[model samples]
Target: MPLFSNKFCPKKPTPRKVELSVLNKELGPEKALQDLGLEIGPIRLKLGDQESLFDNGEWLPETGPVSGTHKENHKLRQYVQQLEDENNLLKLKYEILLDMLTQTTAESHLQEKQMEQLQKQVLNSSRIPRTKR
Candidate 1:
């Protein structure tokens, strides 16, 4: 009468937890976990009260740029500003190109009218009788 008969139940797989230090080392410290859709918070250990004895002498507390949400917000704001500046520059280029296109179109129409007028003048001159030379 075992709790899990080999035939009835398969063994549950153990869940593996990734350490923040490992992630930081692999992904660089500047990258925010939130960017990858992962939440950041304190790490919890599975051990009981006896785990206190294994604590390391050195404790590195979060501080300065690495400490809070402000850094992430700053990065996001800078990214947005860069995008806005790029958008504005593209818009300016588009306007300049449009103006050039408009000017070219106007010039082309003027040239066509001039050509038509020259053709009409040639036809009129040819139709007029000339003195024999």
Candidate 2:
């Protein structure tokens, strides 16, 4: 029996039975973190004196009612309201600008009509018979 025989060689095996989660099925953890404006890094998890570090943190359960989340949400809401007010003001200004433009256009049309009438009158007068004086 040969020691280095073809039977001893490792065969090219197929993929094993591995399960993929829903999140993994979709746009991956890295993409999900990016969408949520978070950086990829190690996460610390504790389970009654047992601490573990994980590369992916999206799956980690939140610490529930985080004070930082509340503060951030409060600030976000305030900024949103401010932006809404600014948008309303911009809308009002846009309406005013549109009205002014419409009024100016109407006035220009009226002036053009008046000029046309004056030109017609001058032409008519020139064509009319006049006494030699």
Candidate 3:
């Protein structure tokens, strides 16, 4: 607590100052900031006014308008080509699976017909009487 209020005194308030005496003296302010991963620099803030909005900050690409557009177009074309290649591969896989399914169905149907023929041959032989020799 103060002995007397500053309102009655003629002394003015001085600015506050800090000093890291013992443990932090070895690591200075810059080293401490680096250790904490803090950077002290002029940061580019998104301003509401058009003063530096159009100015090339870190967000804007350092390229001409036409070149940037061309680069975007090239990326889109590459993406489209990749998608087309994937579509063709999927179509090829679908055709191969369809052909395999068709072949399996045909083989199953043929096996069913063979089973019916064997059953008929057994029934016909049982109906006939065998002569004693």
Give the top-scoring candidate (lDDT). 2
- How well does model 3 score by local distance difference test? 0.73
* Model 3 superposed RMSD (Cα): 17.7
List candidate 2 stretches off by more than 4 Å.
1-65
Best by TM-score: 2
What is the clash count of model 3?
Answer: 0
- State every prediction's TM-score relative to the real structure: 0.48, 0.51, 0.50
Evaluate all candidate structures by whole-model CA lDDT and list the values in order: 0.72, 0.76, 0.73
Per-residue lDDT of candidate 2, residues 29-124 (tens digit): 787677755574667776664444554544333344453575587789999999999999999999999999999999999999999999999999
Give the per-residue lDDT of model 1 (tens digit) for 1-133.
Answer: 7776676667899999868787788787667465565665544333333211122553233344333555576689999999999999999999999999999999999999999999999999999999999
Query: Of models 1 and 3, which has the larger lDDT?
Result: 3
lDDT of each residue in 9-54, candidate 3, tens digit only: 5778898766655336888877877885557555344434311112
Better of 1 and 2 by TM-score: 2
Q: Per model, how many backbone clashes are there? A: 0, 0, 0
- Could you tell me how far off, in angstroms, the CA of residue 41 lies in candidate 2 after the best superposition? 42
Error of 1 at 95 (Å): 0.9
